[model samples]
Target: MTAYIALAVVVVIVIWAVAIYNRLRTYKNQVENAFAQIDVQLKRRHDLIPNLVEVARGYMQHEAQTLEAVIRARSTAVSAADEARQSPGQAQAMGALMVAEQALVGQMGRLMALAEAYPTLKADARMQQLSEEITSTENRIGFARQAYNDQVLDFNNEASQFPDLIVARLAGFAHMEMLQSTQNEQERAIPQVKF
Candidate 1:
């Protein structure tokens, strides 16, 4: 009787561990899939930028510095994105990507604002089309980013939970960093209106 009781206990423990391991694996996969969605949208944005710059170059010839800044920012963003793709959940890689992307956004904003000063550039059909495409891609990226953050939150919660934390540590599942908004407090703050 004592032998039978010991065998049953061992079997139960094995099954419990296996269950926890499977759950953690599933969450990790979901987080990766979420990041992949974001990557797709980012690629679209990156591809559109060069075309936009080319179209704007004709009318904004004197704005060489602005155009070059945009291109350089794009290159940095692409490299950062590649690093993040290799290790989606790693803190350092994600932080680098966010910083790179923020710089790209700032550069792009400057390009567009300069374009606004050039009526001919704004009126060009190619520039308008490229701008629209970039705007659409930006919206898609926002949605994908939100989804990625949600998945990260779910995975972090599961990995850090009581019983699961033990399995997570044993299985070497580290906590993931979520992609936060690149905006600073000033950007997020509401503006005051005067009548």
Candidate 2:
């Protein structure tokens, strides 16, 4: 009777451990999938930057500084993103990438403000189309970032919880930081440009 009870206890413990391991694995994969969504949107935004810069070059001749800032920011953002891709689970790399991304967005906003001064540039069909596309891509990136953050939060919570924390350690599940936008309230607000 004693031997039978011991065997049953061992089987139950093995099943529980397997279940927890599978749960952690699933959560980790979800985090990766969510990050992939952000990657796709960021790639779209990066591709649009050069076209926008090229279109503005002709009209914003005097505003070369602003255009250069945009290009420089884009380069930094791309490099940071590549680093994050190589180490997605590392909070340091991911944080740096998000900070770079926000810097790029700020430069883009500055370029937009400069473009506003050039009525001709704003009126040009190509510039207008590019602006619209870039705006759409930004929205997509925001949504993707939000989804990724949600996954990170869920995973973090799971990893921090009592029983799961033990499982997480044994399974090599590390804590992840949410991909955050460093935009201030003013930066987040829409600029009201008068014609």
TM-score of each: 0.96, 0.90
For model 2, the superposed segments whose C-alpha errors exceed 4 Å read: 1-4, 189-195
What's the lDDT for all of these models?
Answer: 0.93, 0.88
Kindly list the per-residue Cα lDDT of model 2 for residues 13-97, writing each as its tens digit: 8898788888888888888888888888888899999999999999988888989999999999999888888767579999889
Colliding pairs, model 2? none
> Best-fitting candidate, measured by lDDT?
1
- Tens-digit lDDT track of model 1 for 1-195: 999999999999889989999999999999999999999988999999999999988898899999999999999999999999999989999999999999999899899999999998899999999999998988888889999999999999999999989999999999999997765567679999999
Could you tell me how far off, in angstroms, the CA of residue 97 lies in candidate 1 after the best superposition? Answer: 0.5
lDDT of 2 at 101: 90
Off by over 4 Å in 1: none
Q: What TM-score would you give candidate 1 relative to the actual structure?
A: 0.96
User: What is the C-alpha local distance difference test score of candidate 1?
Assistant: 0.93
In candidate 2, position 164 carries an lDDT of 79
